[model samples]
Target: MKEKILNEAERLFWKYGVRTITMDDIARRLAISKKTIYQYFTDKEDIVYQVVNYHIEHEMIECTRLIDQSMNPLEEMLMISDLMRRNADMVNPSLLMDVQRYYPKAWDAFLQHKEGRIITDIKANLQRGVDQGLYRTDIDLETMARLRVELIQLGFDDRAFPNNKDVMTTQDQLLHLFLRGILSEQGFTVYNTLKNKEYNLTAYENK
Candidate 1:
């Protein structure tokens, strides 16, 4: 029951901003009583925190799985980028702003995930790519990795891309530009081919 509540809550939260979702709304969406939700979570804040934690943990697991299965560092990045793009498509642009403004603790958790594990993972990936000759050796791995990490968060800024039609394209172009900057000659060829390939986003549908 708890898992069901969280799943439904997460689905709604992703599609709608968190601040606007009340306990009654969640209960209505799940066709359950508010008491049932209260039995598992103390309040909306509790639900948000748990939901964010679950979301981050699931993403980390997926990241690890993709890295493990990838043939090379570049492939892992491409997969992750597609995953991010698909997810961004589903999320409400105001979701992050709402969380940051209304849910301090949940926001802190997200910050920790971004600054800690996400940065570490990106740096490691960059180093691996460099070693594999897929990335430019002349680049400063740490700095470039951090820059990439920072750029990813910009997708959440609705103001940055005020024209809704261009949001996804702009975000994708940011990633592609980064890839072009880092890829070696052979890596560029591989990237061009992979970019031209039809990426199946069905796996991330309604993420």
Candidate 2:
């Protein structure tokens, strides 16, 4: 029952956004009384906390799984980017922002989770990459990792995906702009070569 409420809440929040959703809305969708909804959740914040926890826990677990299995740090970094891109499309980017904009506690929880787990995982992968000569030694891993997460978030902003997205931000263009500033010559060559390879986001239904 708890899980059902969370799932229904997430689906509603995803399409309509957290701010626009009410406990009545959740209860109606769940076919439960508003009083029944309150029995499990004190308010929308409680529901949102559950939702954020759902996302953060999965995100952290996914980050760990990718990092643990990756043979190299660069691969780890790319996977993180890929995860953000795919997850944004799958989940509610707008709801993600609303959490930050309206729910300070949830936002703090997310930041703490990122700092304590996700960013640390990224830093470890970055250190490994530097050791393997895949990334520049001069670059600070912590800062770079934070930047990557922020950039990924920025990439999902509706403004970034303009209505007139006649010219969208290609994966190649994004990689070229960011990777060029950080990789060594050998790194640049590998990145450029990979960048030249075909990317398949056209399946994103960008039109």
Q: Report, for every candidate in turn, its global Cα lDDT versus the true structure.
A: 0.83, 0.68
TM-score of each: 0.92, 0.78
Full-model lDDT, candidate 2 = 0.68
Stretches > 4 Å off in candidate 2: 156-176, 192-207
Query: Which predicted model would earn the best lDDT?
Result: 1
Q: Kindly list the per-residue Cα lDDT of model 1 for residues 48-149, writing each as its tens digit.
A: 999998889888877787788778888888888887777777887788878888999898999999888998898999999999888989999789988897
Clashing pairs in 1: none
Per model, state how many residue pairs clash: 0, 0
